[model samples]
Target: MAVIPVALAGRSYEVRVGSGLLADVAGQCGKLLRKQRVPIVTDSNVAGLWRDTVATSLEAAGKEPRWLVLDPGEGAKSWRVLERVMDWLLDEEVERGDHILALGGGVIGDLTGFAASIMKRGCGFVQLPTTLLAQVDSSVGGKTAINTSAGKNLVGAFHQPGLVLADLATLDTLPVRETRAGYAEVIKYGILGDRAFFDWCETEGPKVMAGDKAAQDYAVTESVKAKARIVAEDERETTGARALLNLGHTFGHALEAETGFSDRLLHGEGVALGMVLAARYSARRGYISEADGERVVAAIGASGLPISIAALGMDADGRKLANHMLHDKKMDSGTLPFVLLRGVGEAFLDKQVALDDIAHFLDEQLKTA
Candidate 1:
């Protein structure tokens, strides 16, 4: 197992990446298991695939595993389901000293982490992320929240997990579409900061997605390391350092809102398309060469992700898309900050971007796409 430390002073934790980590979770988490029972929250889809392995592992360690399976999808991140999870955790009598295990993708990790953040004023929790997206991005970061009518992740907290088990073996069970969606995030790391990593992905990304264990481990580990450094420097996003992680998120979240946060467009797919938009917009502003913009799109498309807004089949214009972006969390003093690329591997936050310009640019893109 490769261990990456998230050094956050008192709230620090380790993200463990490798195969069979789930089956050996009890051993790794034994020190943090203050109580005989650990409460696990997961979704329906992951329940069938991993419930047994987790339960049997805890059982062997003499720890009682109590689980609550929720309905799968983005809908599970609503207020109603959050209340249900709270009630279940309360009924389980989980204490501050005891840790709750979130075993699934981003939805489960976000919901469970938020629940633990507020339960009894604040309790400990563990992240056993199953999906590729969760393992690389959402699982490591302490940003946890539920979607409200206002916007996505508008209501959430920054509660770090006690430990994160990112078993690469779980990716073997994920569908091709979901795996490709996660690769978008992996590429985002390179686009935002590291030119060499982006070059590496150009060659090894296909192999990583093809179930090459070594390639997948390197990708996940490198991605996690990048996140750990940023998080440790800016835990609460006070400094602009951590915002670089949102390379394609501003445009991506707007696209997600326009799509009704439905399965019609996965979060990573929106992000993949959003990165293309960010790149092109950067090129339009003369921040990067047109060739670099096309390079970004080519990498995303090669991974089988969407590179244009037209592919989503949405009847949206630039004005409509910009309106959705008004709800973005990155808005500062009524001005929305956009993560635009200077070139491949060089993303910077631009706080002075005019929304009107974004609408016009997106309008051009929609027509061309």
Candidate 2:
């Protein structure tokens, strides 16, 4: 097991990455499970695969696992489902001191964490992220959110988890497509900050997708460590340091909106293509060479993730797509800050970006072969 600490001043927590963390849930969470009735929020899919393991663990520790299983998918992160989760948590008589377990992917973690954040003006929650995307990215960050009509993650808060158990064993049951989607975030860490790690990914990314345990361990642990350092430095994203984590998110969210935030493009998939766009846009702005941009595209595409917006077959044109970004939460004073690449490992936030130029660039991409 690799333990990475997200070193926030007073609310610091550990993100434990390993196998059987879920099976050892009681021990992993320890005193965080304060009550006999432990409230857990998860999706039905995760419940089907992990409910028994978690239940048995807590039961063995003389704790009763109370579950609120939600319908699986992005829809669960909406205001309606959030209300349901809040009502259910209230019914369970949860207290601010007690920790609620978020036992699924990013959606579960985000929604549960948001509920906990506003619950009684802030409660504790543990993240047991089942998906690779969650383990490597969303689970560690305090940025919890739900998608609104305006855009993805438009409604949320920065509620940190008390503990995060990223059990590698859970990936065994993840669909291949899901695993590949998660790899996008995994590679993202390398692309944004570590050139050597990016080089390593160019070779070992395949091993990770192939179920190589060692590769998976290294990938998850390293990604967590990278995120932990940044989160420790800037927990609230007030500093531009933390915004580097949004390397692909701005463009990705727009693509997500165009796709109706459905199965047509998973969040990670959108991010994958978004990074490609960011890289290409960076090259167009003379920040990086054209070869380097294609290199980003190649690495993402090699991992079976989409690397082109043209391939999405969307009816929306560039202007329509760029208009979607108008609702982006990152927009400040009518200017949206974009995370663009200076090189493979160098990402900087550019606040001078014009939506009109982005529309033109996206239009060119939409016509790409």
Candidate 3:
């Protein structure tokens, strides 16, 4: 087991990555499980797979497990479901000192964390991230949010988890498509800052997706370590340091909105394609050579993730897609700062990005093969 600390002053926590953490859920959580009745929020899919393991673990520890299983999907991260979760927690008589367990993918973690953040003016929560995307990215970061009609993750808060148990065993049940999508975020850590890690990914990415345990462990642990370092430096995204983490998110969120945030494009899929766009756009702006932009596209494409917006089969044009970014949460004083690449491992924030120029460039991209 690899235990990486998210050093956040008084609220620091550990993100443990390994196999069978879920089997020892009670022992892993330790003192965080303070009450006899432990409140756990998860999606029905996750409950079907690992509920018994968690239940048995807590039960063996003399704790009664209380389960609130939600419908699984992006739709669950909404105002309506949040109200339901909040009401359920209320019925459980949860107090501010109580730690709620979020036992699923990013959706469960985000919604449960958001609920805990506002519950009695901030309670504690632990993240049992089941999916690769959640374990590597969302679970460690304190950014919890629900998607509003205006945009994805429009309603949320920065509520850090007390503990994060990323059990690698859970990845065994993930579909190949989901695993490939999750690889997008895995590669993202490399693309944003570490050229060495990016090189490592270029060769070993296939091994990670193939479910090789050693590869999976290295990928998850390294990604978490990078996130922990960045997040510790800028907890609330007040500094531009945290914004680097959004390397592909701005463009990715726009693609998500254009697709109605449905199964047509998973979040990680959008991010994979978004990074390609960011790289290509960076080349257009002369920040990087065309060959380097193609390098980014090739690496993402080799992993079987979508590398082009043209392939999405959307009826929308560049103007429509660019317009969707208008509601982006990152928009400041009518200018949206973009995370563009200076080189493979050099990402910088460009606040001078114009939506109009983006529309024109996207129009060109839309017409391509």
Candidate 4:
């Protein structure tokens, strides 16, 4: 087992990564596990896969377990679902001292954490992230939210969890596509500030997706470690260091909105393609060489991620897509800051980018896409 700490002073917590941590959730959270029953909020898909093992573990540890299974998907991150979860937690009589377990992927984790944050002003909760996306990124950070009609994560909080249990074994049940989607976040770590790691991923990513245990462990650990360091330095993103994590997110979130936030394009896939756009745009602006931009495109394409918006059958033009970003959470004072690359392993935030220029560049891109 490897434990990576997110040092947030009074809000510090540990992200535990291992093969079978889920089966020992109760043991790991001994003191947090009270005589009262623990309430776990999950999605239908995940409930069928690992609920029994989790409940069995808590039961053996002399803790009672209560389950609330939700419908799975991006839609679940809405006001309606959030209300449902809040009502359920209140009905369960969860207290500020009780640990509400978020026992699924990012959707469940985000929803549960948001609920716990507002329940009686604030409460304790644990994150048991099942999907690779959740384990590597969402579960570790304190960013919790429900999607708003205006944009993704527009309605959320900065509530950190008490602990995070990331069991690689649970990924065995993931569909090949979901596994590949999660790999995109792993790739972001390299694109943001680690060229050597990027090279390593270029060679080892396929194997990791193919279920190579060692490779999977290495990827998750390295990604979490990178995030932990950044979060420690700039916990609330006031220093701009934490904003570097949004490498492909600005463009990616626009794609997500254009697609109506459906399965037509997964978050990570949009990110994979968004990274390509960022690289290309960076080269266009003379911040990086075209060769370097192509290198990023080649790496992402080889990983089986989308390289072109045209291929995805998106009908929205660059102007329309750029309009969507107007509501991005990263926008400040009517100026949208973009995480653009200076080269591989180097990214900077540019708040001076004109939306019109971006639309024109994207229009040219669409011609060949």
Candidate 5:
């Protein structure tokens, strides 16, 4: 077990990463939230998967909670779902001081935090992320959001969780496809800042994907540590430091829009393919060599992830897919920045990207692929 701390001044909290940390909910989370009643918020799929294990731990601390099990998916992160969840919290008479126990993956955490933030202006919330992607990324960041008609995660809040307990054991219940998808985020950390970590993934990644507990523990802790440092420096992304976290997200978001954010192209899968495309585009721009682009693709492919655009089968040309990126929230002054690679572990922001050039390149990729 590795415990990483997010140094957010008054809102600082510890991310407990281990095999069975979910079962220690009360003892661990109780240290921060000294409330009598805690509300457990989760989606139905995750509740069926892990609610009891976490609930029992909270009950042992003498805190019987008001559980909110919602419909699972990105669709749940919506104004309608947010309204119903807030209604449930209100019906249960949950006070502002009472902590919201968010169990499940990123969707549950995002929705619950968004609800908590708006319920009484601001409230307490705890994170118990079950998926690898959530454990390493979303659960720690305070960027809670509900999607809108314009794009994904367009409506939300910056409500941080009081505590984040990530239990690796629960990952066993994840479908193999999701498991593979989550690894893409793990690779993101390496591609963004650490060359050695990328090398480590190439070697130990197989073991981690094969359910090797040691590798999983180290990867989660290390990735959390890396992201914690970034979030601590710039929690609200005002500075360039925080924006680097979206290494492949620009292209990844476009792919998600093409797929409708469905199970067909999971978030991490889109990211996996997007990172490869970003690398290739970067190479085309003379920012990186063809060799570097191939390295990115090879690493993602070795992890059993989709690294090619053709694999998405969206029935759209690259330019049409590129149009999806025009709506990305990261667009600045009506221009979007691309997170491009200079090498295996070197990614920098390219705000000089021209939309016409992107459309032309994407057109070629569509023609070839």
Candidate 6:
């Protein structure tokens, strides 16, 4: 097991990533939870795979397990769902100091954390991220929210968890597509700022995908370390340091939103395609060579991720896509800030991009398609 600390002063937490860690979850989380009435909040699907083991572990540790099973999937991350969870917690007489145990993927963590943070003003929680996407990214960052009509994560808070337990065993149950989609996040750490790490990913990522334990541990450890360093430097995204983490998020979010944030486009697929587009755009502006853009495409393609707009059957002109971008939450001073790459391992946010110029470039890109 490898433990990486996400340093945020009083609200700091440790992310533990390893295979077979679920059996030890209660022992690991005992520090943050009470001996009695520890609520295990998971969606119905995860409840089947893990609830018993988690309950047994907590019971062995002297904590009685109380469960609040939610319906699985992204649709569960809504105000209506949260209201039901809050009502259940209240009926169970959960206290301010008690914690809600988030035991699923990003959807569960985001929804549960948002509820814990707002219920009775504030409460503690633990994260047991069961998917690779959650393990290497969402579970540790403390960015919690439910989707809104405006956009993804439009209504959320920075409520950090007490701890995160990422059990690799859970990943074994993931469909290959889900595993491939999660790898985009693993690649994000490399693209954001580490050339050497990017090289490592190219070398070892296949084994990680093949279920090699050591490779999985290394990837999760390194990704968590990169995110922790950035979060410690800019915990609330006040500085552009934290903003750098949104490397492909601008275009990705726009695509996800345009798809009505449906299963038709998973966030990671959008991010993979977004990263490729950013590199292509950067190459267009002469920041990076076109050859470098090709490399980005190849990398994402090797991971079985989407690397082009056409892959989504998106024949829409760039103007149509740009309009979707205008609704992006990253807008500042009435202009959207895009995270563009100068090259691999290098990214910078641009706020001065002209919408008409973007439309023109995208229009040109449409012809090549």
- Alpha-carbon deviation at 286 in model 4, angstroms: 0.6
123, model 1: CA deviation in Å?
0.4
**What is each predicted model's overall lDDT from 0 to 1?**
0.92, 0.94, 0.95, 0.91, 0.85, 0.84
Error of 2 at 28 (Å): 0.8
Per-residue CA lDDT of model 6 for 11-73, tens digit only, reads 778888887788887778766777477887898888998988898888888888888888887
Q: TM per model?
A: 0.99, 0.99, 0.99, 0.99, 0.97, 0.96
- lDDT of each residue in 238-302, candidate 2, tens digit only: 89999999999989999999999999999999999899999999999999999998998999999
Q: Which regions in candidate 6 have their CA more than 4 angstroms from the true location?
A: 364-369
lDDT of 3 by residue, 1-369 (tens): 999999988999999999999999999999999999999999999999999999999999999999999999999999999999999999999999999999999999999999999999999999999999999999997999999999999889999999999999999999998899899999999999999999999999999999999999999999999999999998888889999999889889989998898989999999998899999999999999999899999999999999878888889888899998999998989999999999998999999998999999998888777
What digit string (tens of lDDT, one per residue) describes model 1 on residues 4-47? 99999898899999999999989989789887888999988999
- Candidate 4, residues 1-369, lDDT tens digits: the string is 999999998999999999989898889888887755989999999999999999999999878899999999989999999999899989989889888999988888998999999999999999999999999899988999999989999988899999999999998999988888899999899988999999999999998789998999999999999999999999888899999999889999999999999999998898888899999999999999999999999999888888888887778799999999999988889999999999999999988899999999888877776
Per-residue lDDT for 113-147 in model 5, tens only?
Answer: 89989887887888888888888889987999888
Question: Which 10 consecutive positions of candidate 4 have the poorest summed lDDT?
Answer: 27-36
Lowest summed-lDDT stretch of 10 residues in model 1? 307-316
lDDT of 1 at 22: 93
lDDT of 5 at 90: 88
Candidate order by decreasing lDDT: 3, 2, 1, 4, 5, 6
Model 2 scores a TM of 0.99
Q: RMSD in angstroms, candidate 6?
A: 1.6
- Indicate the TM-score of model 5: 0.97
**Which one wins by lDDT: 2 or 5?**
2
- Candidate 6, residue 98: lDDT: 82
